[model samples]
Target: MATRPSSLESGRIHHQLGKPRGLLVSPICTSRKMSSKGPCRRGHSSSDSPCVENATLVPTSVRTHSENSSLIASSIGATEVVSQQPISSNVENLAVSRMEAIGQSLSARGISQQVSSVILSSWRHGTNAQFNSAWNRWSRWCVQRQVDPVRAPLADILEFLHILFQQGLQYRTINVYRSAISSAHVPVEGAPVGQHSLVSRFFKGIFNIRPPQPKYCTTWDTGKVLRYILSLPRNRELSLRLMTLKTAMLVALVTAGRCSSLIALDLQFMQKTKTAFVFTLVKPTKCSAASKTAKKVTLTHYPPDSKLCVVKALEVYLQRTKPARGQGKDKLTSLFLSFVKPVHAVVSATIARWLRTIMASSGIDVSHYRAHSTRGAATSAAARAGVSTAQILKAADWSSESTFTRFYRRDVTTSEFQTAVLASVKR
Candidate 1:
């Protein structure tokens, strides 16, 4: 509009607005009488006020006739009366479009598909659940101790690990907590707090104090296990359930695959040959995530008369169960399912439960044997049968012999060659 008075234009304009305590002064209407610094009567200007020399005192109702005239004029100078109008819709839309274009260009400029995938994976919920859990535990611990959790000192992390160790947590388990906390703290701090040199040395000391013990497991008798499976009750209600368990246990033993890999299997991954069905593990597994290509395991069928044939068990189970079938993969269909209502994909825990059921039925202590024991048992049996190390390693999907020899290849029956010779001579 009109030129704003230097005194009234500034933020300190209450004095120019009659110093009203409860009223909001309108910015327009310069014809209204201007108040001076001294006490003055209404509709009058003091001799000291600039309005006394340049502006005429008018009634409160007096208004400018021109619709486009300035609402207010300066009392000190003949300031131009600039007209005020609402901004055009076109101008607002153009401004918004320009801002959106700039934002889109900036967002798309440096982001490639690979970079976007990596960024998304970094913050993805599935990958960071462990981190979140670990952080929450540490935060609660910090709260109990009346210490800051997020900016925890390196010493606090070492103490936390020490506490976990004292609670009988394995070295690897303590390290998992450390890794999770360190990863979460990296965004707030430039570096991981637990990875500090002093903290690492503390970890080394802790490890030396309480080294992790190798977990012990008992192997299963493949022939006896098969016989047990076949002898299970074949009543209408239990036949399908036993058959599915038999097929699952046999396939797991034959392939020497982990529960994760077993539950992830689908019909699309299997190719039938003359004597065997080859299963390709194209999906990422715990061990194969870093590998470039998928792995394959072949399960050959036994003779038609043999009751322990994995192929036969699979065929019987497939025939009994009603999996959704189509040309391509049916996402709703899984290799394994619960016999209960609303059949759905079996998780790794389900496989573990099935293995426990099988183990418990065979007079073996189920607590001492886990589902992963299948891999060890199969590899050890192959080794005992004069199978090559490389063949066993390949079948077990092991990249090296250390894990096979140290962990899987346990001498449950024989301690040494002399004991074995004595036993053989006595027999």
Candidate 2:
């Protein structure tokens, strides 16, 4: 009988034959030192050295595409087994690919790997999706013209931006794409793409042509929504779904909190005081980095109306959902849980939908405004009630008054301008 080829020889043949579609092969016999007494760490025969045959095949779905790419690139002639960790979000994968591209570009410049990692780490995770989108578009544009994306001439960059402008993109959105390019491309004339004199002037011309405007000119009255809430039956008599919507709306209006902040509320960080229920956000919010301390939202008892009391509604909701929360370690700790079976923590988008539902039910024009308009409505109502600017700022977690003035400040009475104009005209 003919002698069998060694495992190492088998692996090479397998690799040359090409890995099966949608599968990744794991490397075998990683150790260079062989055991004299018995098989090596991989338990291969002494005659069988580290080679292709020892590799095991795994499904591609087991690892994220970006992670698989990184592992394959790092290993030399051997495919390492990737960890079983679940794939991350699309944004995270995009971030990995962008960093890898940046690393490859820097490697030719004599930059060390550790320093490149540090440089990549400086970018915020929140901006990955935006930067990746812009970068991909720029790269595609460069490819069509047969130019290097990172080393393109200044005229090419300007031409790309001009094309974006022609596509009816707003001034601010185009500026974001510019910032994305600046982060990736090498500096032009010792200045970033955004800072270049020609680019700056081009942006100024664009802004002058199409000025930015606030999303809402006026916000609906909060009293209208409260009146609708008060009309609902007592919390005990209402269905779990209705109660959940009511509770979410009341907390949103009272706290003027964003959807992200609302979803970040966890029962683990909640406290019940003698007169108020306090919730502290454990997850990161938009302002988390700006403020050193954790943000707190306090809902106090409403002496004027027990039925409309947020604290009371919240307590009743928790009591109603107690059975659904289950028990012990597996119990859900999130403040908001889905009202359906197999109930679990709700995402930020769910909170926004609930708010929008409440707005529609209360007769607010959902077409002209969104769930986020609740912030402007509540703050405007508070201002009309003579609440100080400082108190409004503190409650809304706004660091500057300018933010409120530019974005949140709006006429509480909708159609005021139309009413005024129509009233002045003769019938």
Candidate 3:
């Protein structure tokens, strides 16, 4: 009689046969025949037994340890085998289960499960984090008050918004919480929680009391930053740290891109031309995700200023970091890698910190302005340089001219009105 192979031996056999690690093969169960009732027999649940009809191979990684153990036990009396199912169907089923779980947690009953899943799928990871945070806060409040958060009365929601306002939360933050509640709760009196009459009135009152304000009224001078960058040692002479900073700041200024876009720049999608370096963002940016369009950032050679040219700085930096990409299978292909050992791709937050470092080194007040101010500073400088509004809009990826005018446009120079008034009334 032939002896049965252990699980380890089966794994070795599969490996020797060049089978993919993702695929798992198990011997068929021939100890018991299928009963007349169903595919599974008595004393063996369907989930616990591998019947002839359900003996198809699935990825071991997707199954729990106990399930795999059961499969190994059932394969002890084996003869025939079955082919594998496509992995795509299992992955799809996993995604559907997750969506259903989300729908149940959110108490999303106003829409069908399918529609709710699709709606939830549209939210980005960052949006999900924000929504979850807000929901957790709401849930805590309901627990303290002994009310159901998902089915809470309008009075409870209004009281919660009132408490948030009293806590000195800004209108924008409170509005986010309101939107989060609306997402989880069913409509109240035929209107979303945010749009209900009393809730709308309360929000309007809050807005009137504490209006939203632009973060920066005037942006730092771009020439100051460029001059500082140019004053640094030559690209080849500078240390890897300085070169990385210089390259990042130059790209940030010329492209007027957000940190998200900067970090999403992959070498695989980059195109170098005689006049410019063109990067098509393979990943979706905040604006691109909303507009359903791809974003392209082009950095053209600056002939007038060789030292401050983004293209030259980027080329030198890339060459400097080439050896740092690692050897063998561990090599990295990201546009920006960490300067430290075991270097890997940098995150968006790291790029933001690099921008802030450049700003501080260039004499800009880092306390008053955030890393995001780079967008406003660069765009405002372009507008001052007589660049057309259309070009500015296109470069900044803004869908409307009003977006630039309302949010990003700022005085890059000293306030002319204040200077004129002070000069006329000399002390």
Candidate 4:
């Protein structure tokens, strides 16, 4: 039997006091005088319970069975999650709960690992911000329309997308919205269908998205663009500033160098063995170069005496302006600083703007043209020069010959016209 105070001293005790009305007491005791009241966690009596305005001091989370209250808590690291109610077990709630779990999983890894998780999640769940926005709008629309969001057919999504496209959203932006719907894993409200099913149905024919055309600073005729670039203030401009930007873009125009790969290059990156100063264009810096950081990181000026003129311009800009360290020290060391001053490289936007200003000055109305027009012009120039379509593809870094044949290789078909004219002459 449990120990108990003497019935004569304790108001009443069952068995111990030999009284029929006596009851077993909890660790937090109450006298018969205050019998109607419950004992609190701290063992304090009702009149002076040491609580605030009749509230219990012990957290609701630790309340016992008699209180009929719920307790749910999450403990991680230095965090203490406290709750006083039961969690929902419905599918919608479960999906949200799982997302939080995935987020926590990502938070514990390295940056690359986390980025991989994000990409994977996006493939499965639509990670793009634009797509998320579209999903939200559609969700709200569904609620307003009284359509069961869970059982929404693919046609519903298409209808919503059409409405959005008509609202002046770009095809790419609309596509992003459609992409977000791809992440729908389960029915939103759990009617009869899963979200992925609806998504698959909705997106069966929808993945043809293109990125927005970035704003260019200037636009003009191809000839004007070239002239303006060639006329850059030479000594006043960084030495070879014009040459570097022009060559890089020209190379990008002619060769289709990735903006990263092109910008990450220097004269040293080339081979001095070639007469035209040809060098292997390697190391697109979207990711850091591994295994070559120590030896290949620095610029290798060629012929033992020639400093890349473009690299010289970069040195001048660095000494003059003291540009800050960027994501890649080796890559940002490009000689072509923006004419705007303080910025490191001649960015695509800046190049486009430069072309526009020069074209406007050179009597070309370039306002309607785009930076990509320069790319178009390069193909036109290559075709006019009778450069082999294959050579153009090689210069451009195209992945597929078909793409090069379709877009970059524009050799004119003059043979047919020539043949027809010759036949007439012969006749």
Candidate 5:
């Protein structure tokens, strides 16, 4: 009965407590309070009624119900902890996404840098300088207009072209400006100026309006120029500067060498043979691209009595100048050195200026002639000397006869014209 008395006792004492309010108290908790036991988990004495005052007592049978309610509250708290897991997971996912985006950005930038490096390496030295100049002008124009240069609209390009045209820029210079604009937009912007229909149409109209003018440099007569150069007295009193100029003229005239390739000549590349001297071009010429096999110029010596011999002139120049330190030592180790203090390697511009100085000294008006005229003069002379057209082409390293006909062969077709005249007279 004592064990089963809790249910009835709860019903009988239910009216004694009036209404069961506030916290539900289990029979175990009630018993602990009733008996004079140890202190509660809150560290309060059993004599203190305040600790038990808020708690309402219930029977043993209702004790199971109180336990079940407490178990439900615990389960709810566990569910809340579980719910919080997804928020942390979402935060982690957001951080991961941001990291991935940063990685992709760096990867793209690295690829762009690699592409820019390859493009720059492909350009020739002089061409790179010219492109930089063109790009700088375009950049300044865009800055003045307060517009972006990379994604510039087609209208902007057209306006820039109009400005250049009004400024009296040549047709070739205008084309270069277009090229610079196109290069600036492409790669990063994914748009090239050449692709625009409006730009293409405008260029076509420009070409039709102003046909390209054929610009030619007056031919330097090789025979008269060489004769005058040889007439200059060869004495110890002659400066190394004059000797250098004389050697340059003789080498350039005999080899028909390009001005760009002439500055690249080094003493290490030249070898004296029994009958003649051979010069090995280290870098490929503008016309030639094969680096594995370089082109060589073989100059045979003229008679000992002749002071006009290229081999003799080269030998005299070598003897007069101080010997260069053996091979591959410094950048200034070029065969040609400047006459100034702390002599440096001469560039193509310097070589061109030197050629003009020689022509001026020889009493020729060089107002209309360029340094390249030396190549034309040399090749043309070889053509007139009954040297086969094929041999002349070989000496000049020309892949096509068109360039020869257009620029080098400026002289009239005398043989063909004479033949036609004789036939007409006979008839």
Candidate 6:
């Protein structure tokens, strides 16, 4: 009983006020997948057609539902306006468009995880922190090994650990790798894979996998180190070399400086007043810790280099050799080469090779000794020099190990602990 715009009644319009009737005339509304570009304005559409940003914004208040057909109609420009759609299809398209917009706002940035963490931490502090350079190296390593650090799996890393062990890497080194990936994800129940971190999840029982301990190093005693040096093949300049080796070994054994610091030795650090060398054991400008303060930032561990053995040996080495270049660097320094390639600067490998040569010469059998053996030797010697294990721990900067006490135990003297038996005979 209700109708509008019929050919049978040219001049009259019919309206049944409350009757449900079958008079249908509505434009079909359709649902289209959202374009990758974005939602379009009223004049524009959610079609693949490009959105014109210059177009006026649509007032979002306008909308209507159709009862006659699957098309929604509303009044615009004082005339009937209709939307094309299958009703469900139109709703689906709107849902997808809104979803995509939300996602782009929440997805991960391309920055590395470490870098992102640094940024977040820095922001909390209201200043930027230096990003770690080690991450770059590790990332390059991952790429070379065909592992995606962003998505590194536990299996890939387990195999990587095996490779490291096979390549003569010590447990300490492998442990460093474990630390690189040590961070675990805080899992949320039923969360998406990429949505949450996988770090903590990957190593669910990682602690159960005991990192291989390095060879228990009880063999780097002074006698062993000395014996190794002496076993090296004797040359015509055997006396000179023996003196040098003994002195170097003595300093290394006493000081335990890092390779860089040991190689970086100079007369400037020699404190004649204190009768010791003030060795700055810290690596130069290589760590973020350098910002702490000048002397406080640098690690200075003094070894008794003033002893006649160290001094005389150094004096001899200085007097005997002249460098082909690097005169400026070497002019006032005679402790270690100040420059190389026409000057003198001692190198890490050279130290290692010399130790190897001396070890071969000295006929010592120290399996767990390398360049770091000097550190072991110095700690051991300190233990024997009447220093308490606690004091040695501080002196050696070795608070990190469970075995530092073990390493620093000198022989316990029973006689030193003996008490007099003055009152025991009366009974």
The number of the candidate with the highest lDDT is 2
Give lDDT: candidate 1, residue 299: 71
RMSD of each: 31.4, 19.7, 23.0, 26.8, 40.0, 31.2
Residue 281, model 1: lDDT of 78
List the pairs of residues colliding in candidate 1.
none
* TM per prediction: 0.64, 0.69, 0.69, 0.44, 0.64, 0.46
lDDT of 2 at 324: 91
Query: How accurate locally, in lDDT, is each candidate?
Result: 0.51, 0.64, 0.62, 0.37, 0.52, 0.35
To one decimal, what is the Cα RMSD in angstroms of model 3 from the true structure? 23.0
**Model 1 global lDDT (CA atoms, 0 to 1):** 0.51
Per-residue lDDT over 1-427 for candidate 1, one digit per residue giving the tens place of the 0 to 100 score? 0111111011100012222222122211112222343221222223211110010011112221111011101100010011122232322121112112223333456666555455535433422443444454554344333334444566566766666665555555556567656653422345566667776787788669876554554454443354465466542335767777777887776677788888767767888776666778776666665535787767776563234566666666766775533235555445787877667777877987887788678654666666677677666655654567787777777789997886777543332334435645665
Model 2: per-residue Cα lDDT over 1-427, one tens digit each: 1111111101121111122122111111112222344222122222221111111001122322232222211111110111111212321122213455577667768899999889886565545555665566565344334345576678878977776676565566667668777877778999987799999999899979987667677777665567677689998999999999999988887788888788888888999986678888877876787447888878777655667777889989999999999899998988889999879999867998999999999788887778888888777766655567787888888889998999888874536435434644633
Misplaced by over 4 Å in model 3 are: 1-101, 105-121, 326-331, 413-427
- Model 6, residue 221: what's the lDDT? 37
- RMSD over all Cα atoms, model 4: 26.8
Candidate 2 stretches with Cα past 4 Å from truth are: 1-99, 103-126, 327-329, 413-427
| Whole-model lDDT, model 6 | 0.35
How far residue 108's Cα lies from its native spot in candidate 5, in Å, is 5.2
Worst 10 residues of 1 by lDDT: 71-80
Clash number for candidate 2: 2
What tens digits encode model 6's per-residue C-alpha lDDT throughout 1-427? 0111111101111111232222111111112433344331122223322111100000011211111001000000000011122223322232212112222222343555555545444221101111111122233233333333334454444554454444443344334344433321111344422233442343333434543343333433344344333344432344654555555554555455445445655555445422333444333422214344322112222232222234444545655554432357446453544223444555655665556555555544434355555555555445444455565554445555565644433322232112112222221
Question: Model 5 RMSD to the real structure?
Answer: 40.0
Ranking by lDDT: 2, 3, 5, 1, 4, 6
lDDT of 3 by residue, 1-427 (tens): 1111111000000101121112111111111322344322223222321111101011122332233222212211110012322222222121112233357654434566767668787766545555555565564344333344566789878977776676455676667668767776667898878789998899899989988666577777665566676678788899999899888987877777888889889877899988678888878666766546577778777665567777898899889988888666777777999999768899877998999999999788888777888888777767765567777777778889988887788875465335434644663
Q: lDDT for model 5, please.
A: 0.52
